[model samples]
Target: MNETIARLMNHRSVRKYTSRPVERERLETIISAAQMASSSSNVQAYTAIAVTDPQLKDKLAGLAGDQPYIRECPVFLVWCADLSRLKAAAERHASDKPSYEGAAENFVVATVDAALASQNAAVAAESLGLGIVYIGGVRNDIAAVSEALNLPDYVYPVFGMCVGYPDPEHGAGIRPRLPLETVLHMNGYSAEQSGRGVQTYDETTVRYISDRTGGRRTAPWSKLMADKLTAPSRLHMKSFLESKGFNKE
Candidate 1:
């Protein structure tokens, strides 16, 4: 496998982090690397807020479904899909009054760019002997998060990242992923083959969980997935986007 692939394959979410702080310079390097990731159409419609204050971290943790790890991590970064800059640019260009159609499209592009960039930063942090976790729960209280960060219209928080040194006693090893065949398809699609692979991967995941926790209560991967999809996860996302001034047509 390629070197980058090797790094990616070794990736796992780290929840427990040591109290040691990541230095300012190293944090800057990681942020710089994130900025280098490819943006959609070079619009670079993304912004990141590096958070270090303990009080703010605690408040953010509350907004993120009370995830203590959000407060414990040494460095927290909130990635935002920001279309405000482009809107300003258009105004400066004396272009015809802007519309939310492009803003909506640009929001998606910015989200994709921000996610890619943040993952790159996560990889870099891990490579430097740091533990990192992506906090998707930031969306749990989208309005509060936006208000807390003082985000303006046309800017939405995509996700947050927590980075720190790994906790030796509590942190675990790499968790198993679904089998490759389940995810990788040839030129054309084959449902039967993929289904078989999913079944096998479900068993693999069950066994991995059983071993890791030394418990027999592990649910099969299929059931776990069903539980997720069976309920409405992003039901309010459309309205939330609209509230953020993104009119998705």
Candidate 2:
């Protein structure tokens, strides 16, 4: 396989990092790469906060359910789904835009823009031999995160990224993915054949987890995923989006 494909196939989330810092020149390059990601309607409705403040990182780490890595990472970036810029532009042009309540569609567009940009940054970082991890737990306390970041209306923190050199001793290996046959469908869908592979998948995940974590995780992938989804994860997200000035037409 080619180098790009190799890098993609070997993708793994690195949570632990070495103390080596990413210099400003490299940081600007990564941010430039992130900004180059395609945006919806050319709105480019996203912004990234390059956080290096120790106090702010500690506060953000707390808001992210006390995930120590947030503060420990050499560089932390908070990506935002932002409509505030558009709102400001409209106001600056003296246009009379009405009040907006975020719709599902608008939320989707913002999320897509932010996620694409983040992935681009991640790929760029990895190519530079920098280890990185996406911190989705940034949304665990959306209100607190907003307060901590001093986000204006119409902007919401979508997620965070931790970037640094990998701590060789504690770094993890690539995670297994669902078989291509299980995910890739032809002209039509096939649930029966799709369902058949899940049991084998459970066994695959069980073994992977055992080897990777040293026999610490016994539950299969399905069970672990179910536990996370069955609960009220992101239950407040809808209202939170509505609070921002978006989606209302």
Candidate 3:
């Protein structure tokens, strides 16, 4: 495989980061690459806020489930699914009010746009010898995070990313994934084919978790997922999204 493909294959989340700051020029380059990611109809309805201030990062770390890496990383990026810009654009170009600014379909578009751009940024950062981790805990207290970030209506923080040089002493390794056949379908999907390798995958993950935890935790993938499904998740998402002027439709 080519270097790019190989790099993609070796992707892993890095939680422990060095104190070395990510230079602004390099961060800009990464964002520029992120902007090049494919967008739905070229809407590019997203914004990335790079958090550098130590106190701000600390507060964000607490908001994001107290993730230490968020504060430790040189740059913490908050990727927002932002339709506020689109709404402004519409008002500027044609009407005073946007007809479908809060449409559920547009929410999906913005969220996906943010995700795609963030992944592109991740790849770009990795290419530049930086390590990164995505923080989904930003959604744990979505309202607080939005308030902290000063997000506007029609904008929401989809996720956060911690970026910096990896701490070699505590570097993470690539984890195993489901076999290619399990995910790669010929054309139409086949549930049986997709599920055929899960048992083996569960075993593989059981071992991986054991190794990672020094044998203290050995829960299989299915069991862990089952527990997660049984737990109360972010049940406030519906109301929170509505409050932020998304998914009114």
Highest TM-score against the true fold, candidate:
3
Q: How badly does each model clash, as a count of residue pairs?
A: 0, 2, 0
141-244, model 3: which lDDT tens digit per residue? 99999999999999999999999998889977789999788889997998998777777888999999999999999988878889999999999989999998
**Structural RMSD, model 2:** 1.9
Give candidate 3 misplaced runs (Cα > 4 Å): 96-98
Residue pairs clashing, model 2: 101-248, 102-246
Q: How many angstroms is residue 241 displaced in model 1 relative to the true structure, after the best TM-score fit?
A: 0.8
The whole-model C-alpha lDDT of candidate 1 against the native structure comes to 0.85
Clash list (residue pairs), candidate 3: none
Model 3 worst lDDT run, 10 consecutive residues: 90-99
TM-score of 3: 0.97
- Could you tell me the TM-score of candidate 2? 0.92
Off by over 4 Å in 1: 1-3, 97-103
Give each model a TM-score.
0.93, 0.92, 0.97
